[model samples]
Target: MSNRVINILVPVISILLGLLVGAIVMLFSGYDPVNGYIALWNGIFGDSYAIGETIRQISPYILAGLAVAFAFRTGLFNIGVEGQLMVGWFAAVYVGAAFELPMIIHLPITLLAAALAGALWGLVPGILKATLRVHEVIVTIMMNYVALHVVNALIKTVSNGSYKTEKIQPTASLRSDFLSNLTDYSTLHYGIFVALAMVIVMWFILEKTKTGFELKSVGFNENASQYAGMNVKKNIVLSMVISGAFAGLAGAMEGLGTFGSMTSLGGFTGIGFDGIAVALLGANTPLGVIFGASLFGSLKYGANNMPNAANIPLEIVSIVVALIIFFVASGYIIRVGLQRLKKKKEAK
Candidate 1:
């Protein structure tokens, strides 16, 4: 009857509904849902290697989720996380390869450059919204293209006109041994630690700091915040800067932890866009984003496994995700349904 109870019930019901939908779709497509899920489970959680890969999948997602969540909390729609991520990725990789230093020093330096690059990318949209009164959605959407081409050009220049960057010095790479044995010596690395640290930082900034309050206040009402003597413009720019920085960190994690080099992309990474879903699913909370990111990451990790192990199309994972997102997006409907039930119970 309580809001909290409804909150918990809705997600559980949503998941069951998603599964039911997936089963129906699978049956119609001449596939078996059980077999698909089994394969998906094994690929992500079957063994040590699979588990390592799951962590790998979750690493960048954590950062990307944070990007969207922070923006949402600020009451800003930051569609440019993808662009911010690209520039950050390119900056980190370029710097990573441009220098040679001790592992401890070089790694942090490169990562910082990535965060800064992302922050700059975010600032453009923030300034537009604050000074020019441009809608962030449009500015961010346009910025994605700018970042994509800029990164592409940078990649070409850095790689001597090639589509990739020279590999970073080994010192710049995140280290992991347990995962090395699994994934056939795959790329999972210490970037997970970085992501975890960032999550903690985000939590601290949002929950315990004055700046966070200012941002949230501005998000609630820019005019009110200004009337209350809060610097609304600064908060607006700062929110985007912080949001973009988180996205940049994600790009750095992927570049250094997974790819170990840069590649010229034809377009946005899509992870930034995925972050929007994550933000919504997590209710735009730090902890919620972590769980959302983990769920999505597990699905992605399992997608490849599903086909090989269960004779099912990998599309099932996407279907489940889509259903879950749909349910979350219709939260108002859920609330109304809950209210009707409460009224009937009171009548009884």
Candidate 2:
């Protein structure tokens, strides 16, 4: 098979394998897989509400996935996306709640605050990696903890020891009443448009821009890029900043679109971490990330219905998702197997 064909088949086969394994496990556990899947399907596409919720969930996933994919394309392991997202969430919420401006001004300022906060968070690791020759993964992981504490303390101080902040002002809200009314009162909002626009921006930057070429070149070969007069260090820092900006937009969706407030967290939001899986499964491409986020979002939206409709534990859905990720991670094996089949076919 051609490389493109193999690439397509790998994910497809992985998904099939994941579902098959999930079914076998359900059967062994004495739950009906057919009914479980039916419920899952219904939850994702049964009505307008389900579809709206899925899209709402997918919006953030797309942004987060883009964050990870952009960094991966630049050969950076940005483990700190979670931290950047948290700080961004706080920044967006703080600005949204603290300000009393017109919608035109308030919303843009709030979104900018979130993006800037995330860029600052990512800048630390980028600078460390470029100047001190420190490993990005280590710095980012450490930053996650620091970010959590910093946000928590800030929230506590502002809320007078409370863990949650006040709701954002109406002007700063991203929620769209029209969307909600159209979707049967689902929580879908204008944030989905923001996320989609960002995806297009990312794709354009990576595929058509000179700066993007330099960054990809640096990732491909730092020494060659340096010899070619490209600012490798600058590109490294820029990549992280842009990646964090995407992550921040994700936090903005949550703060301004979904929750409309900031909540102190003792742990990671899980969205950034899940973005790693999303980036991998999406093959680190923008369009791929959209589809990957859609699949993951569907599963997340549908998982709750499985227990009630199929008498299956919620853990089964988790297992299924995990299996899919595992299969995606092991895609190289599938590639090798496909190459062998192609060789045999040619031999015959």
Candidate 3:
């Protein structure tokens, strides 16, 4: 199968398999799988409220997925995406709250601060890898904890030990009450457009630009790239910075669009690590990441709604997500299934 086809189909099969296995597990546990799934579906897609939630969920998943996909292309494992995201969230919240500028100026400024902060956070691991010969995976992992502690401390200091920052100015906020007219109650915003734009922009750069070729070359063979006079160190740092920027934007979306402001919202923000699964499932392409993110987002959004209506637990979503990750990581099974599917079709 072609990479494109596998990229498109693998996630679909993985999701179906996950749901099937989840149903089995539910049955064994004495729970009605159907009712649980029904409730979940209602939670995110049953009503206008659910649709809004679905779009809201997609915001973070999109950027975080892009973060991982970008780093993967450069042969870097940015475990520090969480850290970068945290710092970016902090910067956006802090700057957004501190300022009272016009909407046009405030919005861009807050977003830029987030991107810059994330880039700075990523630059650390990048430098460590380039100059100290440290493995980015290790550095990024440690940095996650470092960033958490640092942000926790900052939040405490700012709010006199409070757990969160105050709400941002209206100009900096992304929500539209007009959306409330469309849906009774929904937190979804137009920030999803920004995520989509980023996906397209990232895809263009990686597929059609010289810089992208340089980064991919380094990923394929650092030694060969260096021999070919490519700047390996530069590319490594650049990749990390770009990856971190994406993560930052993800957190920013949550703060500005979904949550209305940034609160001390990191300890439980598993979205960074979740991006790994999203990237792998999508085969690390920009377009693929968007679809992967949307799938995961929908399941999460949908599962929440199912519980209220069907007496099902929302935690099923987590199990389903885990299964999707596992299958995507081991993709040969998908290839085998495709081959069998083709053979059966040919026979028919």
Per-residue alpha-carbon lDDT of model 1 for 1-348, expressed as tens digits? 887898788767776676678778777888888887788778888877788888888988889999999999998999899999889888888888889999889999999999999999999999989888899999999999999988888888878888889988788887566667755666678888898898899999988999989999999998889999998888899999999999999899878888888888876778999888888878899988888888778877777876787777657656755765676556667778888998899899
lDDT of 1 at 126: 95
Output the worst ten-in-a-row residue range by lDDT, candidate 1.
Answer: 320-329
Q: Write the per-residue lDDT of candidate 3 for residues 228-266, one digit (tens) a residue.
A: 999999999999999999989888998788876656655
lDDT of 2 at 138: 98
Off by over 4 Å in 2: 1-9, 328-332, 339-343
**Could you tell me the lDDT of residue 24 within candidate 1?**
80
Candidate 3 Cα errors over 4 Å, as ranges: 1-12, 313-317, 324-331, 340-348
Ranking by lDDT: 2, 1, 3
After superposition, which runs of candidate 1 have C-alpha atoms over 4 Å from their true positions? 1-8, 182-184, 314-317, 328-347
Model 3: worst 10 consecutive residues (lDDT sum): 316-325
Which tens-of-lDDT digit does each residue in 1-348 have in candidate 2? 787898889878877887788888888988888898898889899899999999999998998999999999998988888888898899999999998999999999999999999999999899989898899999999998999999999999989999999899999999999999999999999999999999999999999999999989998999999999999889999999999998888899999999999988968889988888878778899998998898888888887788888788877778866776687667778889998999999899
Question: For every model in order, what is the number of clashing pairs?
Answer: 0, 0, 4
TM-score of 3: 0.91
lDDT of each: 0.85, 0.90, 0.83
Residue 215 local lDDT, model 3? 91
